[model samples]
Target chain A: MSKHVAYTDFIDCEEDVRIRAKDQARVVALREKKGWLFRLLLGLVLIGPGVLVMIADNDAGGVITYAQTGAAYGIGFFIPALLLSGLIAYVVQEMTVRLGAVTHRGHAEMIWGRYGAFWGWFSLVDLVLANILTLITEFIGVTLGLGVFGVPHVVSAAAAIAVDVVVLLVLRYYAWERVSLWIALGNLVFIPLALMSHPHWSTVVSAFSTWRVQGGFTPAFLFIVLANFGTTIAPWMLFFQQSAVVDKGLTVRDIRHGRVDTAIGTVAMVAVAIALVILTGTLVHGMRGASNLDIQQILSVLGQRLGPVGEDLFALGLVEAGMIAAIALTASTSWAMGEAFRWPKSINMPARRAWRFYLPGLLSAVIAAAVVLIPHAPLGFLNLTVQVVASIFMPAAILFLLLLLNDAAIMGEYTNRKWQNAAAFSIVGLLVALSGVYGLTVAMPHLL
Target chain B: MKKDTLSLVARTDRMAPVELTKAQVKGWVRVVFWGLRVYIVVMIVLVAIGFARGQI
Candidate 1:
């Protein structure tokens, strides 16, 4: 009855939802026609958002915290703590997969739509502020990491910006995700560096059994532990993963694969953190009475103890961590804004089409990069505030997450079980206590 | 010309009009809400006291 247009002609379609639907149908049809290998390959291909969010959780900020943990506490208390965090990360992040699959909405959108404007604005404002502050720390990581290679801060910042722009602007969603995943893989570079340190395996093994704080539970010890906690689970992570799942067009069928992806990411994150702690613990432990050595000092000590190659590798890991976080955080900011305002949001859209959607993220990255270049910018103060701010706001983020996860009409059968709610609330309680203590330590040492 | 438009696989409207029902946070869930709220407030007040006294 009519002419048939090639599928490529559909590229110009304004609504991306149609493209996603058609693509999903095609995949489903292919699965029916093709054998098991094709389905296996499809399954492999579908697991991005979960893995990406988990790996990205071990961002620049997280790396520094891990290094400090290793340097300050040795492989004693934090070794088991890392494993605990991985579990916490998995339990918390798995909810996002179900939410995205069930609702097909970003965290910001869900909050605004269901919980009224006050909560919505609160979440959005907290997310954007934390993302921007954290992005600055990421740039700081990039600059400091590259500084090891004698790269100028400006040059490194510019290069980082260019790489993020290319990845964000030039590539479509699928390609961009692949690129980000590859960069995230670079985080594993810490493993070999840790091996190079030749840590005492028996001691590492005993750390699990002992679970003892080397310096006892002093104010400093508590701070590092809380810092590790703050970095492991952040407000940005919740926004990033939900929007990522929605953007990836993952259906309810894909939620299991999503959980597996998150689990993989959790393993990777824990392993890297453990390695960093061991490496620093072996090399720089008790240095300067182990009073929270700066990252520069930590890297320099690595150079001296493990030689130049070790330092360079550690630096490379830091740079990769920063770049990966920068990309994820920028996208997170964009997604939240897009979701909040109902803008056309998806990395698949061309620059011309989604400029407004992409603008907030780009601007955040740019400002973060610019702030790093300012002379005497009080970066330590910025870093401190980012951690403090994330800590302060984390409870609210977790509360909203629990609320949405438990909502019956929206989540239907996917709602969290009662035990899951108990676990989540327990985590929230623990985090609030840790943050409250850490906040006082920072905001007022006299109390401690 | 005949054109067939593919329907949205995961429609946004599914979540668009939904709002949390009244009985959402009954039982221990309500307790959790109150507890979490108090915990956050206590943390804030402690930090505020610290600031007021210039201990930070």
Candidate 2:
């Protein structure tokens, strides 16, 4: 056993391979059947990781960031800017889908193997820290969401942790993915909230043609842009989606369907983000220090402006965002740790068998849940700092991803094409520029 | 069962480790890696400063 330990991998683990193969075998069955109905059903079955990662992309912090953006700048510039970030989200995430489908490995394992131990350890530590902090924001969203209904933070925290544990330990991969997808639909509650707010339809439409910032270029504006970018794509997303794709048993053949899954998810994420911005922008825009206000303050003003029904809807959406994101984030943490340490890491494994894999993820969630319960914890400050950290870390994460995608020895025929490389590199450049602006703004307060 | 589809998941060694040699990490790749390392460190320091001053 000790001699074989170094070769331990996710698929190599008995439980993981058995469950994944069982699930993928069914997808294969679905593909063999004729008719559009089977195709439709197959589409639903195949749309797991990509969609979950995308919807969960618009996590609790993301919801607040979009809401804050709307409340600050209203709907002119960010409307289109949000959509472009969605495109960026697609470009970055799609690479993971291909990488997973071709390589059948988690992002952590790929980095660990291909780049050597130092880079591997660096990426894993960065991701785990990022995931934990992001999970804290998710819990804050959960508490704030339920607190609107008179639920205490302690109760909300307990309930959130319990639900996450149940969802992870109780379900198999297929069941888990289906259940997660259904839960993710709750994120769309923002669409109804946006519609009910009665945002100026003409302004929303005109935003595309005009594409002009309400306040012109400023450091504050740039920081907000980076924040939105941070919300749209984060380090956890890359790890979560790729591991998910591999666990779901996607092969080179399923890459087309995987892209379909990802495309649908991108559309949903962008649309919901737009709804968030529109809902808050229409009602809360022009308030004093709109950008500076946290979610709780924004919610207070939203209640006053839109009445209890609107407030209640937004609250529910916040809870859903937090819940779905916590689920994805927890699993990603476990999978990354498993890949790094060679533990049996699959949602399909019984908790008893894969306790090592399950332990780290559960502990991270518990820590985050505890953090949110601290009185005077500066949740808003923490939220901003986490976003800044993630934004700063984006280029490094994408650089590793770009490197993995280009390695022809492993990817073989699946290697990234020139266009793909060019697009991905440009995204890295854009993130670096965004990060630089952030640094410049901080270093020289007078400079934009 | 379609063996090809099931084959994707049935195996384990498909993702065996592939460590790079010292000679492999070179040229623009080396420069880019060094540049990114410096970039990440600087950005983190700047963010720490911003957060400390409450300007970010």
Candidate 3:
């Protein structure tokens, strides 16, 4: 009995301390490696969804929102306001990294397992619907972008669809992430377009100090603010990043790197958004009643103001933004569906084994493409509806995320700190209020 | 069999229940859950009314 007791004590000691200590040691050693350049390169290689989600957040619809903001309101108030949205995006997305790392479960799977089927199905339906609607907008951006160069809508849609299929199907998860990252890098084209506009740099900087909206807080101004908020953070971003982190096999050790990845993406997202705002604000805002112009009219104004080269570059940025977003949104839909239905979910899965996972996304793209090809398909209403649905659904999605983060059973020692919970809930309140105001505006335009 | 039993015993010991109570954490969740639900329902009703009145 004495001998047995001694042996059990040794085993307990090993379990209580040795394993984690070894892991901690390994992590420390890995971090202690010398050479800053090597570390940067390693981070670039390691980062995935953090960056992708941010860039993808600035999608086709988002570009138009920012452009319209510039044309309508100019760089007066939105410059700092949009910059602040980057921080909001970071705070929301950071939780996704931690959740993915600690739990090794996608958001849908976690919600379904913990929150019961009602919320699970609710989340799934919202995600799939929003994704499809968002994809149609992406196809719109692609067609319009290419149309400026005389590419027919049919040809543009087909080409975009083909490229998306090949990227999603032919490559495994890591390979797909890398390929998408390269495409995401192309989103920087807007930076140069902003620079090329040659705006009054002092006025742009001084807007930060002045910090005033051009007009007072009228209904029109509030509408644009709501649009900006809707575009910055959406339900798809939450699903996409968490699933990407899990699929990438990120563990707690990788959380720091995941954060850096997301930080880089946030910077890129806001930079491009602000650049578009600048480009449009500088060049297009001068036209009489330019705020009322549609996207086509905005593009036309760009052509007239910036000349052929600048216009072409802006168009290229729009096309790149749409294509990259399509990739992310498609993966997000596939991951969610896979989690919901118990299908194989990883981008790492071979086409043969994961066709069910890929099919939902592919079919969604095809349907969106077909819809975009329809002549005069109520694109305006579709855009407004997408915004409304996203706003209405935002609070619910955020509620689930916060609940999961706080759950002791799921998060173990990694549950949110008290302040994190406070900040997160505050954001939820703001979102709910925004959704309510948006709802009122949509339902009773006269009241607004 | 003896080794396996010992490891299982060790595992359970290492994964002892956390410091926070499930009920305590769940209190916040229930509040946010109901709150968001009420908000969504209100929004839907307003939009429905708008559509009915040709406002949307």
Candidate 4:
């Protein structure tokens, strides 16, 4: 129902067009280069979507989850477990890189075309639903993070949506991506905050060898473990990154750079996540059974233990986490919907030209922000349900990804190698088992 | 043709989508699909029961 009146000359064509033009230009320019330096710069330029997807995966809910993990268990088992998650995220997402580069299709379009409409609709509905639910958590992070500074929820949530609209609408894809990359770099703030706590370096290093939960195995421990794993990789990541590759005009020649981009992002995500865990583990771990403290309580402890500067940094990091994830999630929803419907889907498209592509994404954000502003909305219950739905949808998403990767007709020479398939299937297997157990635990808390 | 024009032309002619009939997709693929269906169905049922029991 929204309309755009004023016209701007900032946008001319869809991002796909702009990116393809840029892709050719880069190739032509690279042909003359003979040094390692230019090659490195080119690799960095190709890094956008990969890094954005991974960092955004560590969203608002993810920050709180990591904080809780540290508070409850300290820097023991999860230090190693989190590193393993980064590798799993890379393995699963790397397939999307190849899939997009080869086929020039988003994840939803691939499922629709290759698997037929039944499964296609299933995946689409799942993705759109999960994207909306996840965005609500991101908004919750946005509102609550700002709430620390006494900013009202209405103002913060509305401002977050406004920032998204301007970013998506005003800048063309190339410029928009550059701006987002800057925001993603903000996620690193947790690193300095963790360092501020001056965690015991030897003890932190020893965690790899010590690898055991501080508390013995219990229903609560399993729930937290599953929660960490669930946040590590979500279905939107697959759709967002593939569509991003296609939009970025990454061809077979750039696949190496894509892998490097994904690897760097994996390192960055794990480091930040580890940093947050260490921060809480150091300051809040022993205080009145830190496992029981919520993020607000965790923040209070950070203030008391490390000073107001540390508390403010934690709050700001939460804000960054929510903002970056919302940016990526908005794009994922738009891109998946556009691909499924075969609409003109590109960030470079002008407002009028791609409104259908843009509307649903904006609407979803609006709804999420609105829900968060409602009084006594049972956000805790909503948060648990969000994970439950994502847990249910994740298996199907991975199954389709595996099938599409294995398909010779579409993927051609880019079809998954045997070792890659083994690694991917192993991750999928673990995810399925954990999700099933997690679901049952939710349904029957007594099951565990 | 100039490289720019040629690239533009290439971008215009998009690739056809990949589609497969049930007959073309078989063996383990079929079995995996069935297993996923059964898994999703059971999970949905369990979730529904849990919700109905007000166990969120």
Candidate 5:
């Protein structure tokens, strides 16, 4: 018995030493593999959704809003407004990445699981309706931009729809994302367009320093400002990123990469937004006042002010913005529908495998295109409807997001830290207050 | 026989119960969750009112 006990102890000691050696070797291997360059590359690969969401958030409507703001107000108040919005967009989207990565679930699923069927159905209806309305605005942008080149609205609308379809269908997830990113880069077209305008550099700098709200904040200006804010951070962004994170197979480990991606996107969005405002502010604002300067009018003004090349560039940027945002909104619609119905919902899924998931997006594109062809359709009214619907739905979307982010059962170790909640809540409160104030302004223009 | 014993041990390990009762919702989390619920309900009511009043 004594001899047997000694032999067992010796075997156990040998096994312990072998395990320790293996563990040390693993540590060394991990350290070697996760070198800074490798990590940087990995982060780049993981950055698509956040940046895409941010850029797509700066869609056709957002571009026009920034342009109008600059043209109407010059760079006085809007430059600071854009900076504040960029901060708010980052805070809101970062929470989505965390929720998605930690839970391995889409926002819809979490809402349904935690809040029961009533709220789940409510959210689904809001997302679908809002997505459809938003998609229509994207078509409006494309058609209007094309009009600058004398292309008929029908042709441009068809082409835009076809491009979005091909992108979502032919390209797998990674390839589709790359194509979208290329198109999104076209947003930077405004930067050169702004430069061509030869904006007074000193005045631009002074605007930032003054952060002046000239004309003393009339209700009209306040309404427009709030509208601009609503455009920047819409309800669709939350749904889109959470679903994108799940589709990309991100986990808690990828949260840092996701955050970095989001930051890059936020920076790009702000740059493009500021550039668009500068383009319009320098060329059109002081001259046109707040008069009815539709997108085409802005383009014509830009052409006269900065030459034909600038006009062409501005039109192309608008087209690209509309196209990229349409693709995102379509995908967001598909994703939300798939999640709500429990259908297969990944770009990774083959068409045959996920036909149901692709159908909603396809139908929405077709319907939006059809709507553009209707005569005397009050296209502006459609755009206004999208904004108003988005405004109404924004609070509910944000509230659900906060709930999920704070749910320990869902988020596990990745629940919102204190600062994140504070920032998110502040954004929610600000949005609610702005929407309310804007509603009042619209109702009683002279009240404020 | 020894192989059978090892397989039995693995199966038994796999069948161990997870301690569900140990999981507790912290007080702050409860507050945040309820707070979010209230916020959503309030917003929904406001939106409905706005729509009814044709102000939305």
Candidate 6:
């Protein structure tokens, strides 16, 4: 009887083992299938933030910057300059994607944890102030763009503020991003505008091959080059992309797809920037005593050169750039505030549930709108403040980025490869040197 | 006997474990790191100048 019992127990154990093996195999198969599905879903999901961040980087300010660069320097140096700026933008933004995915933290939180409160607050203050100032410029762009069509600045500002509120508050995250992207795509209007200019193809092609600096590195040229660079990889871009990635909930596995999105955005951004330069460089530069060109001046010239249609297109592009960037900047402000204060931060959260997260953005928009309405509101001074604060905060932000990227505890096997570190470090060094040169040029314009 | 055995086990469990110290980052590496830091600072300054110039 004991032998019989032992035999029955052995059979039961063998049957259990068989069942377990089958379950394990089934689990493995499902996991494999799920991973593939997750990759596909992630590819679709991760597409928006990277592209939106890059497009927002090429804001109304950037459009004006490129237009001015072309008018001041022509196509000689800036053609290649756009390519270099695009590369720098990609490198810096790619790091943010990776950092966000690996650590699942926003730039503010990372700074707080790694460097502590002082630097964290310093970074936040810079970001908030810069964002506000930048928001003002975006509104300025919207108003000026609409003003081209005989709309009043106040009307345009109000309408723009209205549109921003509707898009941000009424829409979900996915819808908000898509709408912003559609508006951003309006920037491509410059490409057609550029084609209308009938540029010398050979000269344009040779500009790249020759890599010419045209006037041989004068202070003015250096200033323009640095301005172009600064516009491409501004400080807001870092905070915005990091927070966007966090909000999107990207994981390390999504890094490849995120990179693809970033690459597409970089290409699109550079293409638009180059086209803007081409339009102004061909039409406005050296055209019988043309000087002191701003975006308004450029539009006026385009109207004269290519008639009313050209002017209208330029205005539309400017309006789009402004509105899209305003949306992004406002959202970034809210995200940063939420991250810092440990409040619930997501477009997914309903207004009632996430009022704290939503309020900062709404208030920022209101404040910027009010500032724009005031007469002689130190527009130039505010612009300078934005650039200065962005400059001051960039190093601190990059330091935290590098620190987090290098931390094995957080990054595990995905820490930056040595070559990436080398490239990132080189970019950082070059930017610092340029800034020093710029300071000297400012202090003593005649010396350089 | 059980108490004695448990105490011995607890003492063994509490033995000090080995730890790895973080290596100091130095040489060209150190230079590169600081250089990147300075580069970022300069980039900011250039941006400020560009803004001041109001060209862009």
Each prediction's Cα RMSD? 4.2, 4.3, 6.5, 5.7, 9.0, 11.5
TM-score of 1: 0.91
lDDT of 6 by residue, A14-121 (tens): 221212222223222333455667556545555777888888887888888899888877898889889988998899899999887776567876766655566568
lDDT of 4 by residue, B1-56 (tens): 34453344244333222344332668999899999999899889878888888877
Model 6: how far residue A228 lies from native, Å: 0.4
What TM-score is obtained for chain B in each of the predicted models? 0.56, 0.57, 0.54, 0.60, 0.54, 0.50
Q: Report residue A88 deviation for candidate 2 (angstroms).
A: 0.6
Ranking by DockQ: 4, 2, 1, 3, 5, 6
The number of clashing residue pairs in model 4 is 0
lDDT by residue for model 1 (A296-410), tens: 9888889998889989998999999999999999999999999888788888788998899889999999999999999999888778778766887888888889988988888
The candidate maximizing DockQ is 4
Residue clash pairs of candidate 1: A443-B56
Task: Give the C-alpha lDDT of model 3.
Answer: 0.82
lDDT of 5 by residue, A1-448 (tens): 2212222332343221211222222222333475787666566567699889988987888888888888778888887888899999899899999887776567776677666676678888888888888888788889888888999998999999899989998777777887888888888888888888888989888877888876777766886788779888988899899888767656565678789999999999998898888888888987834435877788778888888888888888888888999999999989888877777677766677678889898898889888888988877767766776777678778877887777676567888899988998898889878866755554554568
| Model 2: residues with Cα > 4 Å off, grouped in runs | A1-15, A287-292, B1-23, B51-56
- Model 3 agreement with the true structure over A1-448: per-residue lDDT tens digits: 2223334464444222222232233333445578897677567666778989999888889999999999998899999999988888898999999998787678888878777788788899989998999999999999999998999999999999999999999987778988999999888988999998898989899989999987698889989999999999999999999988877756676888989999999999999999999999998886898889888888888888788897888788789889999999999999999888867577777788779989999999999999999987987777777887798788888888888788777788889999888988888888888888878887778786
Show pairs that collide, candidate 5. Answer: A71-A285
Separate clash counts for every candidate = 1, 0, 0, 0, 1, 5
Better of 4 and 5 by DockQ: 4
Q: How do these models rank on TM-score, best leading? A: 4, 2, 1, 3, 5, 6
Error of 3 at A33 (Å): 6.3
Candidate 2 structure quality by residue, lDDT tens digits, B1-56:
43444453334223332343322677888898899889988898887788677776
The parts of candidate 4 lying over 4 Å away from their true place are A1-19, B1-23
lDDT of 4 by residue, A140-241 (tens): 999989998999999999999999999988877778788999999999999999999999999899999889887588999998899999999888999999
